[model samples]
Target chain A: MTGNREQLLALRQATVSFQGFVAVDRLDFSVAAGELRCLIGPNGAGKSTTLDLICGKSRITSGEIIFRGEPIHTYREFRMARTGIGRKFQVPSVFRELTVMENLEIGCSREPGVWHNLFRFSGGADTERLERLALLVGLQDELSTQAAHLSHGQTQWLEIALILAQDPALILMDEPTAGMTAHETNMTAELFNRLRGQHTLIVVEHDMGFVRDIAETISVMHQGRLLAQGTADEISEDPGVREAYLGSGGIGHA
Target chain B: MSGKLTRQFLIYGAVCLCILLVPVVVDDAFLLNKYARYLVFGMLAIALSLSWGYAGILNLGQATTFGIGSYCMAMFLKLKTVPVHTGSEGLPDFMVWNNVTELPWIWVPFQSTTFSLLAGILLPALFAALLGWFIFGGRIAGVYAAIITLAVMVVANLIIIDQQSYTGGFNGITDLAEFSFLGIDFDAYSASTYYLVAASLTVTLFLALAVSRSKTGLILQAVRDQEERVRFFGYDVALYKTFVFALSAGIAGLAGMLYTIVMEFASPTFLGVPLSLSIVIWVAVGGRQSLIGAMLGAILVTGVQGALSESEAFLETWTLIMGGLFVLIVLLMPKGLAGAIEALVRRLPQAGNGRSARHTEPDHRPETHPNLGGTQ
Candidate 1:
């Protein structure tokens, strides 16, 4: 329930059908400004699909996605990205051939036109901001290293840093901590905690411990629809979530 | 870093110096003309490197742009020679021979040399932009992109050969009067012509370097590495691809014009599959990743082919020999001559401290410097 805070994004009965199979069905979801919302469910629960629909990667079969009071379901991916939404894929997707510095610079780029970048080179005011973002992601030392050469954990952080480079209004992350070591996962949790209250974030993660650490509110999806929405404790106690997530085994974590 | 940058600068300077001093070393007008044409080929190689190497768009029909540029310039020169030699109502000999009446509407603007010169570059650029837009905008990528481009080029070649009267057919446009501008004659064998080619090449190289070094160039490289990721970062990936494609075509067109000037003819062969594929081979052998390497690759392969043609023993088997050499190069050095040179440079002893020296090893990365970001 949003109090005085403005709703940053609202998905009104969003449905995405692949041929005849529905990946996301009438998924009504909304997040207030600066809210760090987590979406968790069993595999094929349409959690990632919701992020995809929100970011315009998957077309909405029926319904509307409103971001900052404007309908964005019909917008293209790049247009949605330019309109202050940043997405980090489930797998790390930094430009592998480029140096970390170059990667961060591109992330921080304000203008996205061919002509705007033609005459420009690295350095200037954005350099300071890029360096700061690198520091935030613990990639300050590896700025000169190519993304391909970075360690798995570092590469994941580089993607996060890349999203932060734009300082976007909303960040859509799909399993941000997947494949990360526990230590790296904890660090990522810390980073996500720090990022909240400045940027609205929707993280689709299965790492329950990591999720419990940073998630203020959690939304659970089952069979292509939102099954429950509440705090971690509230969701864990819900009988429906217990059946869908564990088939009566109940929430896996204490 | 400064030392490495300085070495790179000196290397580029040395290359330019060597090219400029070629006239002094070779006094024969005929030899100079051959070298000038080879340099034009070098420019074509640079164009390929930009699109294929940096942008990751492998255009199999690069000769389409080159041929278009060649025809544009050839049209003007044909008009000049038509009035002087054939004296046939100010119409190109091919058109007159075909028994057409007045000059076609297209030939009227070519009367002004400036229009022809500009059209030579602009037409190919415009054509590539539209083609690139269609290909990239459709999100057709990788091998499909290559196939589409190759198909378009073959179509272009067929069209040129099919229109016998308008395009001079398979024989091409020839027998041109010496091109003159500002009271200066540009004879194919003249040192002035060689300088013109040389100067044009130098300018082209630096302009390409400037582009490849720009922020857009870095972004293009990024787009090549990951297209979807770049899209999420708010870049119009198709536009960047189109931009580089057009730029590459413009350079190729310029090379085509220079080629026409030196060779004194325009042929359908210029747009044929062989020439287009040959351009790809040159870039592959030279080092697609390095512009200078690609240029040298073109010059080296072209020069060797020329020499082998003159030898009685190798005359018939030169294609075989070149083919074998190409296979060997691809097998032994997939990155081409430039990558080998770069690895060698990194292995050599450095004057700098151990930190900078350690940067050369492929597997090694410098230790994390926590204070590095804070210093600024």
Candidate 2:
């Protein structure tokens, strides 16, 4: 987990064009082993599209995405994901009809083929891993509760735990706290601090306070380009970044 | 146990029993046999529930696979009826008229009942795979998938109608050889045929349970809820959809094989839109999310229609009753009969145990709030 961060994932001047519009343009970015990089942007700034490109959920129009130094453009979204780049969606996309434990169990459990999932029995490790992972995510108490009943913040945590259960070295979360109370937001910040040295986390968030607390290096995006990249204070003070975006956000104690 | 769930199960169990006992209770054995046919339809409903109820994929082409199985069964039966002199080519009269001098290559392997049964199941599975690959591969979405399958049903129906010389066309292949499993003849209307139907229904139900309880089932449900999110989670959304689609098709085929034996009739009409349409009704009316509910819906809807259609007062208007019931279930009971029964059972006054109170314990915790698996 601590060795070669640059070799793990690299996007070399990648550009994505949808029709005539460029979503993410010539963005050169990379995630290191155990790096907690926060991606902050105004709405529609392509924070999500960039992650989508690297994961193969959305194809790159040009440029290369190197995974552990191997350019992995050949892999499709699901196939590439199977290689262990676990992702968490902005919306809590869990098996809502299933119980909380069952949702985590599903994340840890991957059937060899699609057909087997339908007929094969659950192995013992799946259940054990789920219980252990639930405890890790602070969900042990609600192991059997139906996911539909979970609170919004609980759902986000469940999604994180699910990604963790996948045991991937890299985790990408979209807007981990778009709508959350200060208490939930503060707790989430604490959770991210613990994730720092263990898993390489790339979070796309709108909450500046939340971002400032967790992100070691914050990358600011404006209109599909990386406008600034540094510590929270550096990006906040950058005049170009402030004028291009963030200027409208009266961002205050209010 | 929760009172609501308990009542739901009890009501369902009671309804199943009544349907099962109808034959023994009725004065006429002939009428009782008809009730058994409706139960075969119930198996399809159960399979539908596995996908639609738990997985949330509404499959409109269940009858397509069911018809495929029936045709395979019919093919074996037709072959058996060939005169001893003509040997393998001893064409069934219909094939002779169609001038099939050589047996269709596809129909050759169905010589043994075991092979025929296997073919009946596998052919639909194979078809589902191809269809799933095309649709779930990401080209089709929502109503488009439904339309493509509906088109398949139409094409199959037209083929069944046009190939009258070979398939018995409009009438479909009939006078099917009675099922003779492992050398035991099922020619008589003994409880044997009924037993076979029951066994198949039970087995299919067991298989569905295994599927729903498995990890694949969870992925399928997840995919249904958020295909893009599931994809983002490193799942190939299309792959899950395709896999579940094939599994459902295979189970539907099993239901069809049993149906052919119970009715001893196989027609293109069985493969047509009407039967496919009826299965949708069975699923929606039974309950969209519960397998047992869907299964019960099929049996109840079919059993009631069969019973009431014969009544002197309502002989011609059973369609109206069935249609009305379908609408009523969809509108008033989004969960279907299973949901309705569960709701009813909640009011039965079980003071000893209350699930809501017990369930709230986890929610009442604070220190465990950040945990993903906790009550969330």
Q: What is the DockQ of each candidate?
A: 0.54, 0.43
Q: Which interface RMSD does candidate 1 score? A: 6.5
* Model 1 global lDDT (CA atoms, 0 to 1): 0.86
Best by lDDT: 1
Off by over 4 Å in 1: A248-250, B1-4, B83-88, B350-356, B359-376
Q: Per-residue lDDT for A1-254 in model 2, tens only?
A: 32454556788888899998999988887778779998987777889998787677789888898876677777877667777687887767787766786677667735436655545544344666667777766778787678888888888889888888887778888888867789988988998898887888899988888888898888888778888888888887888777766456632210
- Per-residue CA lDDT of model 2 for B214-249, tens digit only, reads 667767767666666677556667777777777788
Interface RMSD of each: 6.5, 5.9
What lDDT tens digits, residue by residue, belong to model 1 across residues B1-376? 2344445557767897899889988999999999998999999999999999888999998999999999999998988874554565567777778987787788789989899999999999999999999999999999999998899999999998888888889899998878788898999998989998899998998888778877788888888888899988889999999999999999999999988999999999998888889999999999887888898899999999999988999989999999999999988887789877877765665644556655544233222211111100
Question: Given candidate 1, what's the lDDT at residue A26?
Answer: 91
lDDT, residue B183, candidate 2: 73
